[model samples]
Target: MTAAVSSAALPALLGPHCTVDPDRLRRYEIPERGEPGKASGLVVPQTEAEVASLLATCSKNGVKLVISAGRTGLVEAQRPDGEVVLSLEKLDQPLSFATPDGEVFRFGERAAPAAHADALAAWWRGIGAPPCEDAVLEVQAGMAVDAVNLLLAPLNLMWPMEMGSSSAASVGGCIANASAGANAVCYGTAAHLAIQAFGYSGDGREVLSDAPAWKAVPEDLLAINSAQPRPEWGLIGTQGVLGVITRAKIRAYAIPGQREAALIPVSDMPAAMRIHAAARALFGDDVEEFEFIGKPALELVRDLKGDAFRSPLARHDAPYYLLLQVKSHKAHIDLAGMLYEFLADAVSLPEDQIGYAPLKALKEIRHSITEASNARMRALGGGRLSFDTATPVAVFGDYLKVLEAELKAEYPDMALIAFGHAGVGGAHLHILGSKDAPVARHAKALVKIVFDVTQDFGGTFSAEHGVGTKWGDEFIARAPAEVRAALIAAKRRHDPAGTLSPRSFALDRQLAG
Candidate 1:
């Protein structure tokens, strides 16, 4: 391999796009969780051409590049380790909207992109325009998720992939990680929403998903792609190992006209599962979100946020809580009445235990779990273990029960706080230990126990969170032999020099091994 490029030499080679400033480099190194890493330099590319040129230079020189956008990743994918940081923050612009037939709605007419959802909504209402049908938004990968929604709100549409860090999570990062949030049960994951992608391979070759004939294709890209099959939508989950995604066309959905949510106290996981089934049977596709929050997680939020964040239920004694929401785009549908009827007739939940809440309020309580858990971990001053795992919906309840039992039996002292998108059979499980009873010493063993249970329940250890450096070994060990070979081949094919995101999923180490 060629010698790695030095940070000092970057500015001379790439001009103003590259920076060796320590302060800016430090900002790109911070991850949502875990220790920060060190970067040799930071490069902020403003256009697709610049991104292509930068990748070409890095590939030729054997310089590693870690793609960073928003810097809200929890798996340390954005955390550079002596590699150059490619920040896409400056590429935050929504290009346009188009229908399948090629009708385009360019943003050039507007002075700037929509900044607030409320203002956009008011403007859209004033126009009295019908919602755009079969709409797809072509947006820069660096655009924040919330900003995308803000732009869509005016059109009575939404990207629909919701996350707690929507304000900070970028379009490309979500696509790279194939993230599925609370609304995933209805709208599905990023892979499903992203229909097209345009980017550059690690070797600096322009890559594009099959663009319709109406869309203009770069002459050079077309010439280069004459022989190779275009990358499929599955590229959404490659985690940047295959290529760097600069822009994508994401599918949009009509905003629900009527929505209602409720927090129902449950005695245990089984009860939550039963309620979830009842809701699905009652409302079908209208069940937009169903979240599970363990008692410990709920208690943590209350303790951290004080009385203002206390449980809405009259009695906060339930061992678990299920946040259920139903929505429909049809204006005539009585979503509120349906939800109340489901709770009263199907689940038989008592009035006192059923807490009817606004959709925004329910979301606040659900999203606060992560912050509250992090705060509790810091206070304890011990090792922190956070897992994003998923199981088959049929066995989700049993999976949680088995996992919880194993944790209690193996490490009784470690505090457990579990919550996540129950509608999609995914859970965010956290283990916190006090300094006096640190779990760091047995971190490996604890992880093994959890993975084993997940496997037994036909679940994935790395669900929404991609296989960053944190779970690379687990992926290598657990992936089928054919799957490993395919990934290795793709790495060699797209990133021959191992220049882009060499540290992601430890592909560099895997290649060497």
Candidate 2:
């Protein structure tokens, strides 16, 4: 039998950290699309003990939980549908940085390192890294990605992941989603950066990458001695179905010394691909980010930002635009000069059509595409059907062309806006329908069209945003048999009772069958 908790009994059971108040509960209800979720209560657990206790109670009673941090997820994973919301926001603090050998640097009382040169040097040496080289950070899961970078900024280091929602995306959420951003082409995804994770399994057992007893050892000697591989490796991209990540160690990199960016108008996807290839050939690893923006998406940005947002390109009528950025850590490297030289020599665009801008300005325009698309949908009194899809880089240009053609032909009234990490063959496609033909009415058909094409091109249906409840059914039905079986087996092994994120990927339904 499924267990149910009463609102009145929550406070008595979970202490002062639990709340059933509607107003407070509303904060965690907001979802990216569809109706906002409703929950019985919200629980804020500050430590691993509290999280484990709550999970134990839920496991024993068969009450469901939805793990949430930052509430910035695009997928419906965080949206609690009558289940209790277990929030890790209270655990938002840097714990300690430990090397592979177990040397720990505690950031007690202060989240960031001391500002003095001596203190900074001490931190660098403690991690056994040269000044401004690579390092690792141990932080609570609730800590925001942007906050992590802020703490590392003083040390001339960074976590290196860039998300449109970095300011609100939590460390745990990034790991759960295995998120990749525009710069993922250069730095890789969250799974690549995370070294170790500490969390509670769905059954309330302590699941840690390192030894629990290591905490009692001298701080200098706290290292991993386990003969078995870290169990947290399986939990990284599982989206909290297996466990709730409380703490993690993530790799950090020194800030690049020279960074340069350019925005160039292109005739179409093929032209954009040509320029992308040329940039990769010329700069190699120095090519940090290469992004594509459809004309409709660019127009939305220009219209929404109004007169202040002028197009960098001479003409705004181009079917596509490419935003290219290159960076180098070597202080003396002339990245801007080399980038300009490449543009002049390889790009066939007229001098007027090619435009250069600061990296920050160019990223701002790229990041604003989602906001603009949402605004357009809202204005039209219709909802949006957004997709995070990817294909092999070799056929990425052709894939987009086919997708655009199929989408326009089937749903001509729907405005198709496209943009994403072109360097990595990932794209975010949004379809906004007119009031006369609402997208909500054609949601399933639209999804089928996109997913079918994605399969044809040998691409992923859900690339970085994970398959939450929104796409769970499709994932189960359409994902390869082997992949589905593997995920199901993992889910069964880690969360047999389906106590955590029961709705995600419809694990409960799959298990029931």
Give per-model CA RMSD: 6.4, 6.8
- Candidate 1 Cα errors over 4 Å, as ranges: 1-3, 99-102, 109-112, 115-129, 210-234
Q: What root-mean-square deviation over C-alphas does model 1 reach?
A: 6.4
Question: Candidate 2: what lDDT?
Answer: 0.78
Clashing pairs in 1: none
List ranges where model 2 is wrong by over 4 Å: 98-104, 110-130, 209-232
TM-score per candidate, chains pooled? 0.92, 0.90
Q: For candidate 2, lDDT tens digit of each residue in 410-505?
A: 988898999997777788999998889998899999999998997788677777888888887877777767666777777777776788999888
lDDT values for all models:
0.79, 0.78
Compared with the true structure, what per-residue lDDT tens digits does model 1 show for residues 43-80? 89979899999888888877888888988877787888
